[model samples]
Target: MEKTYLRAVEVDQWQTRQDITVTIPDSFDREVMASLPSLPDEPEKAVEWSGMLEMIGNASGVLWQKDAEVESLKTQIEIQKKAMLDECQGLQAELKEARDETHRANAAAALATNRAIKAEAWLQQVKEALASGFAPHLGRAPVERPSVLLAR
Candidate 1:
């Protein structure tokens, strides 16, 4: 049997691990490798490493919770955006209906105006024929009696 000495040293800026150099009999090397110590012997380094691993776990948990919240908020935002788009489409349809109604009303108004103009023209022609004492030169048939005389 041979004696082995292992030392723990800090690695990088934030980590500590064992640094060991050993010469052992071939038969004992396999046993030594199988039963190597997992933790540093120094109490302060062990405590620090344990606390750091715990902090990392806590931070990872917080990050996962925050990610879940972010996803929930994104889903809510998508729902709101869809609702707003539906509302906008509805409003657009309503506006188009109103515009179509206005166009129909305008067309009806134009027709009525044209009819009124034609009525006025016809009335003026009739008045002129009466004032001219039933002129035969007009396109109408000659009247044998005046309209007023016939009315009486």
Candidate 2:
């Protein structure tokens, strides 16, 4: 069995009309001729496939160009997809870092709150000590003294 490499191609319906000519492979030409009946130079009845003939006349070397353009666009789409994925990953990483920082800030705030509570208790003790008038030689509390407000 003989194998022929053939690629199925699609072309844009819009084609140029510059009177370009093309030659098909001999085997393909022979096969087409053998399979289909030949059209007469002049026919009495209207041809069924005459429209297809006119369209084919404009599609000789233009299909490859459109095909290449399609391929290039597909490549660009893939590149854009990769870049978007990378950007998403970067954003996710940034979110994780922000969450970590938030947790650290919350921890620091809790520690500060605890220190403030302890400091408030210590300040209360100091106020009591001051009221008692800490005099080591005298006593914890002095006898009832005259009011300075009355003296004034």
Candidate 3:
């Protein structure tokens, strides 16, 4: 059994250096060693052909999956953001509607109070006219204010 030293050859205009150390296992001649390309200073560059190809393929697949997952997460985040924005707008609209309803209710209450005051003033005037007919001296002077009834 003869020791077969592994070697590497730099190909013309290629980034990858070819493994030129594929020994004819049965050949034990020293002249065969001379024909092989020179080995590099770094021994890690030499690898079993099948294993290195598998590693490269697996790495590419993982990178592709990572990119796809990132895109999916980004889309989900955008959808969630849009939903939150829509909810905010809906809440704002509801708040505005509530404010408008409160304003209308306040205006209606003020109008009702004004009408009540006018009605009370008219009723007092009519009462005074009726009393003047019975006493004959009720309407001879300045009329008493309706606000005096509220004070009593």
Q: Which candidate should be chosen as best, given TM-score against the real structure?
A: 3
Arrange candidates by TM-score, highest first: which order?
Answer: 3, 2, 1
**Cα lDDT for residue 120, model 1?**
72
Model 2 regions more than 4 Å off: 1-57, 134-152
- Residue-level lDDT of model 1, residues 39-151, one tens digit each, is 55653543333345446656755765676689799999999999999999999999999999999999999999888777776776677578576565666665553333211
My TM-score estimates for the predictions, one after another, are 0.53, 0.54, 0.56
Alpha-carbon local distance difference test for all models: 0.65, 0.62, 0.65
Clashes of each: 0, 0, 0
Arrange candidates by lDDT, descending. Answer: 3, 1, 2
lDDT of 2 at 96: 100
The sequence of per-residue lDDT tens digits that candidate 2 reaches over residues 32-72 is 54677655875565443434444664463356557778989
Stretches of candidate 3 exceeding 4 Å from the true structure: 1-46, 134-152
- When 2 and 3 are scored with TM-score, the better candidate is 3
Q: Which ten residues in a row have the lowest lDDT in candidate 2?
A: 143-152
Candidate 1 lowest-lDDT run of ten = 143-152
Give RMSD to native, each candidate. Answer: 14.5, 11.4, 11.9
Candidate 3 pairs with clashing backbones? none
